[model samples]
Target: MLSGNTKFLQGVQIYLLSRDHSNLKSDFRHGNGKIMVNCIENQPAAELVLGKHVFLSVAEYYLRTKTG
Candidate 1:
């Protein structure tokens, strides 16, 4: 387990605070028509997941740093 640090928590807090999900759709709808038989084309969900991954990567860097 990584050591508990206030800076890492602060970073996560900032990341979470920057989100604006008011315009996000709360349902699944496929792109290129539903006839393609593929996963739903959820742009908001995709962006949130991608952003979370990027945040986690940056947080990992801080965790691995000496001064963190």
Candidate 2:
């Protein structure tokens, strides 16, 4: 069983791996925050298993720490 943070990071890596550079840049500039939050929020089982506010906390941290 993966930890919530590990799952989230893996999800992000998998998601990024499926996109092209241009699309990734567009997502970053546009609706990436909402998209990421939605992705995490949609995983109900993961949320329940992790036993924390995984989506919001991860999203907030990602936003605050991510850089070019």
Candidate 3:
């Protein structure tokens, strides 16, 4: 259980997540190219498009449902 003082670690997306094990290394980068990016939760990746944003944190969405 989390206490009032317990702090949640800032979830950072350092690399693009993938299901393919072979692509795991490639997910980090290709050649000298680096794809370091972090997705902010709730904030729209771009202007609001219909009811959904370009990217949303699946983990946070799941946690909200279970907690609520």
What is candidate 2's TM-score against the reference? 0.39
For model 3, what is the C-alpha lDDT against the true structure? 0.33
Q: Mark the regions of model 1 whose C-alpha exceeds 4 Å error after superposition.
A: 1-3, 23-68
Residue-wise C-alpha lDDT for candidate 1, range 1-68, written one tens digit per residue: 11375554455445445544331112112221111112223211122222222323465456656453
lDDT of 1 at 5: 54
**lDDT of every model, 2 decimals:** 0.33, 0.45, 0.33
Candidates in descending TM-score order: 2, 1, 3
Measured over all alpha carbons after superposition, the RMSD of each candidate to the real structure, in angstroms, is: 14.7, 9.1, 14.2
Model 3 clash pairs? none
**Candidate 3 accuracy as TM-score:** 0.24
Q: Return whichever of 1 and 2 wins on lDDT.
A: 2
Candidate 3 or 2, higher lDDT = 2
- Which 10 successive residues of model 3 have the least lDDT summed? 46-55
